[model samples]
Target: MGLFGKLFAGPQVDMAKSDANRKKMRELFNEVVENGQDYKLIFGFTEDIGWFNYGFVHGSKTKIGNLIVGWNDNSQTIVVVPTVPDLSGCGDATFYRRNEIRKAYQSKYPTDAFIIYPDRKGYIGINVCDWLEDEKLYVYVSQEEEVKEFTDFFLKRFQTK
Candidate 1:
């Protein structure tokens, strides 16, 4: 879109307040996670974690909640938990190729921001702005043991023959 086109763009859909859109996004997230992939959900608001530049780009902070981090085995891609407006009050879930990933690991900071790099071009910092936390559940799966435990629990609750 050109500059004038952007200025004339239609009103953005407020997914945060729409049930249909919320359901769609939730399903999309589930599908992304259920394909024999590994994922972690971290609880806490964006501010507490700190991805300052991203926050600035997004126009605001992520509402306090869970941030889903997942690794897709088939593509070797690390999926950034897209902001679900209705659920997160942030934005939408977006994907990035593993090669595009500059880094992916837990932040060394005291607050522990689970980070995925290439958060922004030429920028280095905690990338919390991408996830708009809203849920209360916090499930951290950083270690091998934790991943196994989470897998067991997830399969038991969500798997179907």
Candidate 2:
């Protein structure tokens, strides 16, 4: 190793891990397509990791590919966290409530960005942009692999069913 290289930090081997994460995210997103009726979503690691920064509550199991949603009556425009989290009302109408859950989960990882796609009823759809805030994927991606990542994350969860 060069003198300067040894003195400073080394290369990041975590890139592989990030790619794996992206793939999983794609899987999860596709799985949610069938039941996108009412599923709010968020993009906080806490949502999936299950923990709150406030320490009041913990253990939030994200529905794999759901978006974190919220409503602001005063604004009358539906303010969402990280990204907008509306519902589609595909399966359960509880998507509205799910939005709340996303917010609750976001307490811990505030910077964990996510993308919420809502249907006509202002219902959120899937995590179209779960990795948007990821530093690894700072640039826009339009490759087939990107889609696969979301699909994998969504479908994998439904395998048990």
- Model 1 residue 133 CA deviation (Å) reads 13
Q: How much does candidate 2 score in TM-score?
A: 0.26
Best by lDDT: 1
16-118, model 2: which lDDT tens digit per residue? 5555543443334335433322332223221344545556655555433333332222222222323112222222212322223232211113442333333
lDDT per residue for candidate 1 within 90-120, as digits (tens), equals 3345565555655555555755444445654
Off by over 4 Å in 2: 10-13, 34-43, 47-161
Backbone clashes, candidate 1: 7
lDDT of 2: 0.33
Q: Report lDDT per candidate.
A: 0.42, 0.33
Best by TM-score: 1
lDDT of 1: 0.42
